[model samples]
Target chain A: MTLSLDLSHRFQGFTLEAAFTAPPGVTALFGRSGSGKTTLVNAVAGLLRPDRLRLSVAGEVLADTTAGIWQPAHRRRIGYVFQDARLFPHLTVRQNLLYGRWFAPKSPEAAQDFDRIVALLGIGGLLQRRPGALSGGERQRVALGRAILSQPRILLMDEPLAALDEARKAEILPYLEQLRDELGLPILYVSHSMAEVARLATTVVLLEAGRVTAAGPVAVMLAQPEHAQSLGLREAGAVLQGQIAAQEEDGLTRISTEAGPLWLPRVAGEPGRPLRLRILAQDVMLALQAPQGLSALNHFESVVEAVHLGDGPGAMVRLRAGDAAVLARITARSAKAMGLRPGLRLHAVLKAVSVAQENIGRGA
Target chain B: MTLSLRVSAVATVVSLPLGIAVALALARGRFPGRQLLNGLVHLPLILPPVVTGYLLLLTFGRKGWVGQWLDQWFGLVFAFRWTGAALAAAIMAFPLMVRAIRLAIEAVDPKLEQAAATLGAGRFMVFLTVTLPLILPGILAGTILAFAKAMGEFGATITFVSNIPGQTQTLPSAIYAYMQVPGGDAQAARLVLVAIVIAMAALLLSEWISRAVARRIAGT
Candidate 1:
């Protein structure tokens, strides 16, 4: 189902104007802190009333201020997974998951089943436990299950992983990917992390100071220089569009990208599925002469588009491959050694195993 | 003594829900003249007992506007009846009950109520299930306060409802009656001891109940 949100809300000393149509997939509202990403998601969930707003989910009019139509939060059918999880502390995990089901409109046959949600989120073993007894990751998983059992047409996740540590984030990301793939429900995910946006988002909506700076599919937007500035040089990288070329022996998998065929550690998925590999700027090594790499397995010939020297001890070199651009953050010593300059011809060397499977964005 | 206890219990029970409703309104709801409503609820607590009783009598006596209407419409009487005594006692205790409940409601986390609303509960459902249960300790405290106040109510009951024997004469009224008559001083002193015991017992009972509820809800 499609979710269309066009809203303008003004708060004290801030005005939020955002408009986007998210298709059935995970659409990440990417931005920095205080960019009104949470405000936009709250508006979609009917938690915040916008002055002049028009929002509809799958053709159902949820809010249209000009038309004098506004459905309250309860009737909106948009489940929100807050950053804090917000699970009912008074109830057990099982009761919290089933809390929304009791109020769900009865049907002759429920399409979005309940038991399926329990197994999907892997909360069967934790049904009897309270939210306080569960770990951070477990609480998030249960929160997601509760939201799904509510049978929401669209799910709004606001930094669901922000409160979690890196390890906990890794633990919960797979379940989120499973939900995106299995449930077929549209999700409007809010986050400040571009890595998360690159990994999970089919569409990226970049917000800055309460406005839509850029919004489009992950691949094209990430390639733009404007989008690159949103992500800093060190974190900025190319999202290599590729398919599972082949699985090599010794547990490494080869994938083809616009730059060239690349190999990475074996990912836990079938062959022929599309994958997204994030090549960080720090990971790329530029060579004036195509040096025979001692250990690195992937190399791509590119033209250096621009070079920005840092006041510290490094330089950021932007490289353009076949259709996408890659960044290389190299020390000034190495840049001078290689005689690197803007519009210079160079070959970028990247280690095959250095690009871990965790960086790969699975198919939406 | 038993009549006084029964009168206090009846008055407490009758005014408990009204006090709770008014408390929640004062704590949560926004309306025009809210401050005025708050002051009106607190008026009896600040005013002298005789003054409150005089106001009640002026409005609820047999020839009064409300009393005449009740006599004509439903043949109900609040003038010099046991019901009238209970009303006088409830009015005297209403402020204490309302103050306790209002503080409790304010202490409850509103985010919990918002969470309930997100789970498909309407406003009334959220209040009934989430807000009310969490404030039960406060309600119990309010009940005990109102009960104690009603048991000690003397000026209001005698002034508005009259100290009629076997009808409106509660324990306090009986004690007052005995103190007025010759050779009834011993009876009046005995009733005072009964009042102290009842008040202390009510206080201890409320404390026990409040602790039990707090432990259960707070999981301690």
Candidate 2:
């Protein structure tokens, strides 16, 4: 399924003109604050009647202003998870989750399916409790459950985890990953957190001041140095799809990527389960030959896909390791000495990649 | 005392739906004559009780146009009757009820309504399930306030429906009648104490009910 939108909305002093198509996966609407991400989401949800709009989800026309077709918010059949959780305070957790189901048309999409969703979100214990009694993470889980039970054509999640603290965010992120993978539903996730975009997004739509600056797969969007300014320089990195090969006896976990198998500190996942490999550009190193290892494991043969030199002293080098793309941010002086160009074959080294913090996450 | 209670209870019950509707319109509706409607709803609150009663008499008295039409068609009369006292009390209490309900409606977050819409609830359904439930405390408070005001209504009831013993003479008018007589001090004092007790009980009852309601809504 694909969600497509063409909206032109004018605010008091700002104007937003955006048109994009989101594929059937987690497509992150990535931008900073006041970049019209929320406005666009609201427009899609029919909460805000944009100055002009033409939106369709999986070939179903939702709104086309020129054609005088307008579906009110209640009839849109799109679920939205707001930043504040917006759970009905007067209703219990179970009632809040079923609020939408009451009005949904009779089908699997709108089925009560109560016990399954409750167990999936781990909100079974909270069924009898009210929203006020739940923690931030628990409330978000219930909110997600509520949106899903509504049986929407597409889910619009506007910074669903933005209100939670970092610890709470970590607590709820795995549930979101489970939702993305298990639900098999398209989610248009709005966020400014590049790390979240890198972890959860299969596709990235970079927004800047109400316009789409770039939209592509996660690998290309992050590895593209031209987007470094919007996607923070330090946060820009390569996102790889990999599977767990084995758990090494030395407390290391081997992940099989398209490029080759890379070893990291013990990551908790069963063998053959998918894991996303997030390598910070600064973490990758380059070599002219297979150098003897100090602590590094294997080197993979790769070609220089693109070399970008900025005003700063650092230069970004995109490397093609088999079918996968890896980004290495090396010094401009080193690039000059190595004569790195678009097509030079070289060995891309991992240099014992650190698993500090959120460098690895569950696959979507 | 029974007459006063009957009048006040009838007045409050009769005015509730209108009070909520007017309050909603005043708080959220964007239309012509909104300011005029708001001012008209509040007229009884600001005007002297006697003035409001005189206006009601001109409109709803048996000899008045609407009152005459009702008498001829439905054989109903309000002038110098217990029903007229209820009418007076309801008018006097309208402003308080509208104000309380309006403030409650304003306190609700519009975001919750938006969430309900996305959940596939139409506008009326959203109001029934979300808006109405959330404003229960406010409604209770408003109703109690109106009831209390109606119970205490004196000047309007006396003006609109003359102080007729056993018919329109409410507790307040009855007390006034007692105080006008020489050596009626003891009876007047007892009735004043009774009035105080009733008012205090109503206030405490409303406080307790509203507290329980607020707690339930908050889920704490």
Model 1, B188: alpha-carbon shift in Å? 4.8
Q: Please, what is the whole-model Cα lDDT of each candidate in the order they appear? A: 0.82, 0.88
| Window of ten residues with lowest summed lDDT in model 1 chain B | B211-220
Task: For model 2, give the RMSD to the true fold.
Answer: 2.5
Q: TM-score of A-chain in each prediction? A: 0.87, 0.93
Candidate 1: which pairs clash? Answer: none
Provide DockQ values for all models, in the order shown: 0.42, 0.85
lDDT of 1 by residue, A1-364 (tens): 8888888889998999988899878899988899998888877877778888899988989899999999988888888888888887666788888877767787654544767888888888998887767888999999898888887888899999999999999888878877887777889999988777777788888899989988888766665544556766556666776767788889988787777788777765667666667877778888778878358878789998877676768777778887777777788888888887778988988742223233234335
- The TM-score obtained by model 1 is 0.88
Task: Report how far off residue B216 is in candidate 2 (Å).
Answer: 1.9
Model 2 chain B, poorest ten-residue lDDT window?
A: B211-220
Q: Is the docking of candidate 2 incorrect, acceptable, medium or high quality?
A: high
